[model samples]
Target: MRDVIEGFLTFQQEIYPNRLELFKKLAEAQSPKALFISCSDSRVVLEMLTQQGPGDLFVIRNAGNIVPPYGPEPGGVTATVEYAVAALHVTDIVVMGHSNCGAMKAIAAGQPLDNMPAVSHWLRYSDSAKAVNEAREYGSADEKLNALVHDNVYAQIANLKTHPTVALALDQGQLDLHGWVYDIEAGVIDALDGPSRTFVPLAENTKVSALSTKLG
Candidate 1:
């Protein structure tokens, strides 16, 4: 906690001053390129991982990186997705999941979360991912967790399409959706291959980002 405070002080006194002019421009308006949805895990730092500064990405982080299917009731994730697509006109959306995610681990292990009722309810959003695990056989905990991480990213992407705004943008070819799994220890990202329908090296994940900026 002390280190976190000290880091903030360093950013305030040094980093913020260095980028004062940039911050002033950002204060006026933000033109972000993508909507990044990921787990609210400390190991995964958005800006640091993407090397994106300030307003490059509109982000939403939650326990499981889950996005509930658009329905009668709208939540923060739904609202953010609508705003990023409809208002900000972001062209790219990335749903990212990381290795050994606790949320997925709990689901995979069938860990009882009786005390954490909200978490229990929230993880229901991952029901589709749970289905993926049910159809497969895994001999180890790591295998189960890894499979959950990858499937969860894809499941979330499917959920994203249920949003009217996302559906419209995708239908009109105004948006590109991406799914990703980050390997924390290895520092590697596996991007979902649309054609192959498999995860592959994500060396070109940011290709759409630059083009989206121009289009936006």
Candidate 2:
């Protein structure tokens, strides 16, 4: 706790001064480039990893990085997506999963969430991901975990499309969707290559092969 306070002090006294002009501009309004959805793991710092600062990415972080299908059940994730697209007009939506994700591991192993009813219910959104990983052949636990992490990104992207705002933007060729898996140990990211149905490095000239990309 003290460390966090000190870090904030450093940012306010040193870092903020250097970026005061940028902060002044951001204070008036924000027009972020993309909607970044990722797991709420302490290890995954979205800004640090993407080399982005404030006003660059609108973010949503949850236990599994889950996005429940757009429907009667309203949630913060759904609302955020709508506003980011319809109002903020973010051009891209990135659903990211990471290495050794606890939620994915639990789902892959069929670990009982009996003690955590709410968690179990929430994770149902990623049930399809578990099914995909289980149906495939993996030689070891790590491989299975990796597959689950990647599969969840796909599942959530499908869910994102269920939003009317996302659907319309995609149909009009105004939006792009991305699925990514981050390797914590290696500090590398693998982005989904939609056309090839594979994960490839996220870099310049690289494109995501997902519904939004296909439609856009």
Candidate 3:
């Protein structure tokens, strides 16, 4: 807590003054271009990874980077998605998963979560990912884990589409969806190529439209 307080104080003393003008502009309102959904892992810093400043990307984060399918009892994730789409009109939504995800490890190992009921319940969102792994053969545990990470991103993208606002935006061609897997060890990001249906390194030359298809 002390560390966080000091950090904020440092920001106020140093960073904020330098960026005061930008902050003033942002204070009025925001028009973020993307809705970035990612894992709640401490290591997955979306803004830092994307080099985006405040007001650039609207982000939603949860354990496992999960987006629960839309239903009558709308949760925070659903509400945020609706707002980003209907109100903010974000042009893109990026669902990012990372290597060595604790949530994926928990799902794969089936670790007893008797003491962590909430975590166990929240992870149920990855059921489709688990099923995908169970039905396929992987060369090794690492490969399987990597596959699970990718599959989870894809799964969440599908779940995102179930939202009415997302559905409408997609139909009108006003929005785009993306799935990405970031390798922590390698410090590289693989953007899922929807047409080729494979992960590729993010490069300036990479055509985003080629990777916009719904992930399997």
Question: Model 1: clashing residue pairs?
Answer: none
Off by over 4 Å in 3: 209-216
Candidates in order have lDDT scores of: 0.88, 0.89, 0.86
lDDT string, candidate 1, 29-52, tens digits = 999988999999999998999999
Model 3's C-alpha root-mean-square deviation from the true structure amounts to 2.5
lDDT of candidate 2 over 60-108, digit per residue (tens) = 9999999999976655998899999999999989999999999988888
TM-score of each: 0.92, 0.94, 0.93
Error of 3 at 61 (Å): 0.8
Error of 2 at 180 (Å): 0.6
* Each candidate: RMSD: 3.5, 1.6, 2.5
lDDT of 3 by residue, 1-216 (tens): 999999999999999999999999999999998998999999999889889999999999888999998886445999999999999999889999999999998887778999999889888888988998879998888788888998898888878879899998888888888888889889998887777777778874255532355332
Best by TM-score: 2
Q: How displaced is residue 203 in candidate 2, in Å?
A: 3.8
Clash pairs, candidate 2, are 194-209
Candidate 2 has what TM-score? 0.94
> By summed lDDT, which 10 consecutive residues of candidate 1 come out lowest?
207-216
Candidate order by lDDT, highest to lowest?
2, 1, 3
Q: Which stretches of candidate 1 lie over 4 Å from their true place?
A: 204-216
TM-score of 3: 0.93
Clashing pairs in 3: none
